[model samples]
Target: MDLAFSPAEEAFRAEARAWLQANVPNPPLPSGDTKDGFALHLEWERQLFDARYAVVSWPEEFGGRNASLWEWLIFEEEYWLAGAPQRVTQNGIFLLAPTIFEFGTAEQQQRILAKMASGEEPWCQGWSEPNAGSDLAGISSTATRDDTNGGWRLNGQKTWTTRGAFCTHLFGLFRTDPEAERHNGMTYLLVDLRQSGITVRGVERLDGDEGFAEVFFDDAFVPDVNVLGEVNKGWGVAMATTGSERGLTLRSPGRFLATATKLIELAKSLPDTATPELKDRVTQAWIDAHAYRWQTFATVTKLVEGGHTGPESSMVKVFWSELDVRLHEIALELLGPHAELIDGEFAHWMKGYQFALSGPIYAGTNEIQRNVIAERVLGLPRK
Candidate 1:
């Protein structure tokens, strides 16, 4: 199949490129790791929102340009090519907004999507509990209906919640019907963090950044309207959310391309003592980066053609997560003695390696992705 954009797509690309060139800034290189740089990145996101460039794929009614998926890919490609800062509203716009648009009621969409798109309501995913990391079906957070009141009462804890400390809202899955099967008994709930019954405590990462948090719900009240999708059909909603997480949100080839370019630049500036292995590693990183770019092109084309991502998005997830780990590993190797350095560019690489360590863990672990490839793609027998 030819992987070329049409004339209309080319024009869209040109428009996006011009807009990015005119508005985006090339700031000082990111300091520390992901968490340390989150706030600054968020500011950059607000700037994009103000310019109407944040969510390019959503319908125009929800603050996006209603561009086709192909145009979305082209816009993202152009944005990264211009060295623009990453958007902090990514989790909100990419993951949550799409779910809301597809599965949420019209009123729900009206209440949530605009704030999310405009960066007025930052959101965090509340899927993984301490007891249920990869096995999301094991989540035991309870959301019982309060007979005396006209809402549900949430009571449980969520861990490894990214941006939990600062997020205004949380989208989570809770056990709504204890008698039903594990997956069937659940419901998706939107928790307003500003409410009285919720508590958020920071969890410092290996890199000493407090980006993730543990959130507690002590009888937190959520109106019936806050329930996402159906009350007991949250498993399907979560599955779709996971698909979006894997397909669209987490693995942006444009973001990785920008990162790969930075890695190449850093490698070039290293000492002559750089080992042959390190050089080879850098070369392989570039190749993998390019592979992911082409894969994204194919994926976006499929989306434009009204085809779902199927198991291929899982393949993309595996590719990018492993590439990310390998890239950071090579960076750490290149840093050599400075690998342990806690400041400057060396520190940034160290912090990135620490965060990259989680790639396999989040959005369903790499092991899970492999299983998906086996069972869904290869038609392997489930043991």
Candidate 2:
């Protein structure tokens, strides 16, 4: 694949860079997990929507410019370089909307994707449950079709829901047929967060924040049209989204490039304290970030040529997540004893360290990802 950007991509990059330099939050918005922060980010999303920067790869009817994949990557690079606020609508824009576009009905796409892009209705993922985390096939949540109501009655609990605290909607998986075996008899269901009989309880994590929550569905009612794909085949639909999450779509290489840039500056600040070994490690981190960037470009090239992302997504996920953990570790090492502090100048890296550590566990654990690579990518026996 050609590493150099085309003339058009270069022009797009220049446009995005200028816009971001002018529009990024001055003081920066608060964490979107908090109530006040959510409002701030919501308005910021609306601004991006108005500018058609929310999802450039989407069609104009869906509030995007119908930009090419390369343009989207260029936009991401500019976005991170500008240090813009994190996206609060990622669950909808990145994760759910892809599957929605692939499997949703015309009415569903018309109603959902536009609102999601405009931040009029933000969404959260409701995939994991008390019984199912990495092994999503073990999920016990059930969605039964209601003959009387002409819809589905959802009754189950989902845990570790990102953005659960404030999202207005959720797209999730539920067992539509208990008699069927694992990975079978499930349905992808969409439920309104404000609907009755649904309970959302936040869970505090190492970050001392309520970024994740547990959502309980006590006979929650969902309209029949809310189903994304066919009943008893939700596993396929859900995997498509999960593959996107584990691949370059969710965690763009731009983020790692930005982190690497910060690490380089930090290393310069610690010239006297930086040992030869530490310097080498920092350089390696920078290389790893570039490697991911190249890998993403290559993968996108193949995808544009009509190839699909498969178990290779797991490999990408494992590499980047572990690289994130290592990058943060190096930052802490640079900060020395001050790394433990959660306030002042050190708070930034400390917060990043906490978040990086969780990256390996979310989407799918590294252990699970490795197995997928071994069996699917390497053609090894699953047993």
Candidate 3:
């Protein structure tokens, strides 16, 4: 149960902290979700890549430092503490990369990971559809075999894809068998978004950023080489990605801890507005962030001891997403009327609050996560 970092770990932390302090943009770059801002973010991504910090825990052969998982956690804490730009390439690094490592061939690994680390080709998730938001098994997108073309022909649409309009690639699940229903007969496809028969339309989010997109496919062809894992066993493969999305990888405690620290500072600056209830909430949020941090460390330790992420990730998802909302809510409350400002000093709080609102809805809704916990973690009956 000990949580102390070893001398080596502490030295690693110091090294990461120094580099980030020296490199992170002083004024901060614009949101990576916007077109112009995305360009700026790409520049920042390249800076990190050049420093070998883009994918620290990845293999050395694939544009990474080959750091241990504990070091990875330490790096995340330092990255957020430095107020680094949003990782425009996160969908690939955090979610899809692990799946590729687990299910991809050597050729696929060589083809994908380096470009991803360098931000030469960014990736987005194509999970939710117009009809299949939470129940991903209900997606109607299809990828039929095209033996003549030596590929699969995709024909359907994916909606609410984060940064879909800006990304160069996509990783998603598609029904490969016409007769099969639900999660069966699906295939995981790595698609080039620039290819023919594909359309990406940006969707404006509550924060006024075009962070979400709807992607359409009509007779889009993907070479057989782009397929990850087995053709019709995509459900399992995709679950691995989703497990990361909902688990420790995607929404790390570092993010919440950073916000909580900001929240406390904001509260301190507004002593007059800090009523007892508001003060208590701020304290609670800070404590929750620390609790989550230690909890995540315990999980990481378990993983080091050969355990795996699973349904318990659902619990982690629900807690962190809700914690995010609460932290931002308190920030907005502290800002008072200034929270309504969309420009200047108070703008980030409002923007963060809006983004926080979507946390429960994406990465499978909190409601859906609770069901996963019930059925898989608690072993409850489906009824």
Which lDDT value does model 2 have at 219? 90
> For every model shown, what is its TM-score relative to the native structure?
0.92, 0.97, 0.97
The candidate maximizing lDDT is 3
lDDT of 1 by residue, 250-350 (tens): 46677678778878888889857467878888889999999998877777666567667678667878889889888888888887888888776467678
Give the candidate order by descending TM-score: 3, 2, 1
Q: Residues 82-125, candidate 2, lDDT per residue (tens digit)?
A: 88998999988988888987889999999999999889999999
Question: What Cα-based lDDT does every candidate model obtain?
Answer: 0.80, 0.88, 0.89
Q: Which stretches of candidate 2 lie over 4 Å from their true place?
A: 244-250
Residue 217's lDDT within candidate 3 is: 99
Regarding lDDT, does 1 or 3 come out ahead? 3
Stronger candidate by lDDT (1 vs 2): 2
Mark the regions of model 3 whose C-alpha exceeds 4 Å error after superposition.
244-250
The root-mean-square deviation over C-alpha atoms between each candidate and the true structure, in angstroms, is 2.5, 1.6, 1.5
Tens digit per residue, CA lDDT, model 3, 1-383? 67688899899999999999998997988898999999888888888888899998888899788787788889999889778899999989888898998899999999999999888999999988999988889999999889999999999999999999899999999999999999899999999999889999999988889999999999999999999999999999987665552232646678888999999999999999999999999999999999899888877887778777778888988999999999999998988899889899879898888989998998889999999999999999999
